[model samples]
Target: MTSINVKQSGDQPNSTHCRWQWRDEELVLLAEKAIWRPVSQELFVADLHLGKAEVFQACGIPLPSDDDRATLLRLETLCERWRPKRVVILGDLIHGRLGLTDRLRADLRNLHRRLHAEVMLIGGNHDRGVQLGTLPQHPACRVGGLWLSHEPEQPIDGRDGLNLCGHIHPTTTLRQGPDRLRLPCFAFDNVEQRMLMPAFGELTGGHDCRHRYRKWLVAEGTIVPWFDSAHSSRASEVGR
Candidate 1:
């Protein structure tokens, strides 16, 4: 596990004061990702494309060979540490219309059996044809304070409070010295009360976000404010 340090900046005292810790709580932010314990140790991940590489290969797009296996391994490593009771996939569990191949299905089934945790899926754009209903579904399922869903909706008054969603694979640009880096990030909207997660899929693409909401750049295994002027300039240049 990576050790995270909390630093205080004069400009943003409140935000900086927020320590990134993994505990049983309503809200915990880690490396630009928010962890919510709505139902015990249930961990939520968004946009994990199990068979993305195979789908791309079917389309004649030659991608790196080990993308799917690598992503599954990454998830396994995360789950092994967290030891969650369940894993709720927010959306886009599969990539493309090809759906879950036999190999991918077997991988998911094996993961669920090995972890001994229930796996739930909320349908997303790419999951239209996928038979997620064939998998287990839980009643009163949730992540954070909001009910998990594929699409983002306006918050209903006095209900659930906020929605935890992932569809727009958000990315932010940061400038360090003369060079600039565009990194995948998680975006939180305080006014709208929605949390957009960074895509967890190894074969997925990201949408660079500027002029949308406040951004936090995820680099060096920590979440930092992407508010520096140079960062803005780098974002502008990349936008152009």
Candidate 2:
């Protein structure tokens, strides 16, 4: 288990929202912690570190054991709400071999059956340590002229389609008064034509998205635009 220092995120109640547009495709960024592609009717999520709590508990870190269940339920909820035809898990579906348990496997199979959506996984670093069955070991996947990956690596020169990835577990810091809140975010690097997704697991920590790109912070049940630079603070907020 990676001994990462976890931060408790603030709770905000809001409807599932935060939509964006790219390449003539409408992206519905659900507060449920998934991206809904309207054109393909697919949901894209990343970095679900299932069974991470068990790993931490084994390492003497006091963490709740329900982390895996919570993560799975959240995904199920999104599926029920959006009714996507398919769900594309970017990477790191499970934490590692030790984290992969029979119970977890059962839950995954059950969820797959319940959602009845074609689930595609593009393996990530953690997934490399285990045999996740049928899912490809390829570093990237192509779907509808878009590149889906676990890491945000630039494509070969002039490669067509934009790259969407998750690994860093990006987040944005919002300041109000003397306090600052670190919230999960979607980091879009317009310059690189790549987007970084937030960690979808409840027990997962986050990487502060300090890169110089636009970000959408999940707040008050909606997605708000967070400008890393004072220059872009004048932009409008984006959400449902």
Candidate 3:
């Protein structure tokens, strides 16, 4: 099976995205594009965009209507695997106001309503004006000295921590000769002191990573280590 290695500072050899010491805590960056904090027993997923396909269809765009179902099934699998005490969604739970059709809302409500973990939603720009209907909304949520938000904006709640954000749907592109491959990624901006998680929603789009950040691209059921290219962060990743 393919695996992702998370090396801290000078530590090397091998370890799955299982545990990276961050903020004095162990972070399990799952290959599935979610973060599992074993200490807190919390799972973090971002940019679910539940009804995104419906939103596109409403505009007469052709998109499979089952995107939401597929997305939720993944979430259910993660929850079953980790069984976290809490699940915090960084933001963009819905694509837009129009995406929340009655069926969509009911499905969301049912999913959260039955999950064993405590669910929290940080309102994203897309979430505004949508009827969340008792989905445990918050403007920003703080967890383990990290500021969790939908966007990379500064914390408005006057609290402080490293930012864990989504909405940019960060991705990294690899090029060799004439072939180009693009994959979703977990990108960290050291200067800005924030990390952007890849979009959890399967049907979502991605924004390219800026050269300044270190990237770990998710492809083929594993996190592809940064290549030897100029934009690479670590020397560990070999192109697969």
Candidate 4:
């Protein structure tokens, strides 16, 4: 097992952002909105829900058509920066089959052509409606000592590894006096040994998860590790 100690940046209390150490690998929680594993040369993004805007538009709901474009651009920027060998998407690659417009398909195809990294998608509940040819699909995959999946589930009977998943679209709420702030966050359940990724989709909503385990809030181009009120004073102290 691996352990984490408090990480300090310069002289400031840098509890908001830090690399995640697991087993024998060190993973970077990128501000570009994805997990970058330098050891494996892979990037993990979850709950993309591509084509989501189209789904809403189909239902006569006025939604921005540029939603997918924005999501793809963010991904492309990350790809350009990290230059990973593979980009593993946890799930919700597409909102639905009907929502997969030709333009969206072309955009994805172009993205795959432009980037050197291989993109792979794992099926999720929302993925059931996606056409098979829209995106390459897999049930699950193994990365280093981690099990990657769309839904947060324990690995098969004998497998022993930390599970990384994205389905609930975890978010965290911060309360200060009468003011409160809610933001998408990466949630880690220490007891279950699982990590929940925030949604990468531009149009998808988030589910607020304000439980006790560790949380990394993504805001304003920075990833912040949130310490509860009880432990706020010790935020500078490191060690898991």
lDDT of 1 by residue, 28-131 (tens): 44452435364477777888876887777788998765787877777777777667788778878788657477777777667787656777887787777666
**Ranked candidates (TM-score, high to low):** 4, 3, 2, 1
Candidate 2 global lDDT = 0.75
Off by over 4 Å in 1: 1-25, 32-39, 132-144, 155-160, 176-178, 225-240
Locate the minimum summed-lDDT window of 10 residues in model 4: 231-240
Q: Candidate 3 lDDT, tens digit per residue, 1-240?
A: 333333233443333364555567667777789988887898999999988888888999988889888888889888988898888988888998878888888887786655677888888888887778868668876776788888996665676567889989998766544455677988878777788999999888899775677666677666655533443532214333
Candidate 2: residue pairs that collide: 14-221
Give per-model TM-scores: 0.77, 0.84, 0.85, 0.86
For residues 1-240, what per-residue lDDT tens digits would candidate 4 score against the true structure?
Answer: 232333323454443346889878688886656898888799999988888877888899988888788888889888888898988889887888767888878877766666677888888888875564646778877776888889988877467878899998987655444454667888888878898989998887887765455778787777877656355333322211
Reference-based lDDT, each prediction? 0.65, 0.75, 0.76, 0.76
Clashes of each: 0, 1, 0, 5
lDDT of residue 8 for candidate 4: 26
RMSD (CA, Å), candidate 2 to true, equals: 7.3
Q: Would you give me the overall lDDT of model 1? A: 0.65
- Compute the lDDT for candidate 3: 0.76
Angstrom error of the Cα, residue 6, model 2: value is 23
